[model samples]
Target: MYRLVLLVLLALPLAGCFAPRAEDTARNWRPMGANGLALGRLVALSPGVTRATWEAFAGIKGQTVVRLAAEYDPVRAAAGCPPPEAGMVRAARSFLIVDLAVTPQKSVDFIAAKAQAYSADGYFEEYDLDIGVIAALAARARPMPCADLALPGYLR
Candidate 1:
């Protein structure tokens, strides 16, 4: 009886390891804020693909965005993609504006294509609607608030 109880206790812990993981269910669902964007929308918007496929694509795109956002400096400098006249803060905000205007499929395609091109050439030189999307997102970014010296230290 003691041996059986011991075996059950050990198996109980291992059972969790065998239990299905969320990744197995929602493959493309990235934790939010990974790239300051929600990639699962791509799966939700796409037609014909199974949920699993869409989830996988979303995961891939999320990782791609994170990587690209991190490597943006090198690509921007190398490709001579116009120096952001408004600054990267504005450019980053521009992504929100661009997201509002484009369909998920289009956004996914744009990112995927750009990532592919970047992977091959170490730059993003091809111009398309995506360029306009980036510009718009930058243009629409909210400016930082002016500092108020009169305000209390915490409020300021």
Candidate 2:
């Protein structure tokens, strides 16, 4: 029984290696809860402050990290994501939706901690996401003007 449990534990990472790729469009991506992806491996598909932060945090000394980013689009959220948190709707339109994503290296605890930090900063709401979904969102995301909503050194 101990051996079986050990085997299962060892195979967990390999399981992630086989998960389906998230389609490259918000319209094609599954809804948040329905996205059949583990909470680990958050997505960041474009270069920006958030992406840089995530890379510094999770990219271990020799690990090949894939960094990405997506600008938040309220118009696509209704179709691609779950309903926004209470203040998110107004904030999304007014403030830059600076959601952050980490690749599949850090533990869930690490992400939870990062989320707490991001939330306490009072900038944008954080969401658990897979790299594929983020890629899809990135593909569909248009360059919306965020100069008025952006905070210095935050997502851009």
Q: Which of the numbered candidates is closest to the native, going by highest TM-score? A: 2
- Off-target runs (Cα >4 Å) in candidate 2 are 1-58, 79-122, 131-156
Model 1 Cα lDDT, one tens digit per residue, 1-156 = 999999988898677755433323322333233553333443333222122222122344232221121112222212323443332211111111111212223232234212111222222222223433333222332111111001122211
Global lDDT scores for all candidate models? 0.28, 0.33
Model 1 TM-score?
0.21
Positional deviation of residue 76's Cα in model 1 after best superposition, in angstroms = 32
For residues 1-156, write the lDDT of model 2, one tens digit per residue.
999999998898788755432212221223244554322223333222132222222345432232223333333323333444433332342212222222344212121111111222466544343334333334443222222222334332
Q: What TM-score quantifies how close candidate 2 is to the native fold?
A: 0.26
TM-score of each: 0.21, 0.26
User: Which residue pairs show collisions in model 2?
Assistant: 44-68, 44-69, 45-68, 45-69, 46-68, 46-69
**Model 1 score (lDDT):** 0.28
Positional deviation of residue 139's Cα in model 1 after best superposition, in angstroms: 17
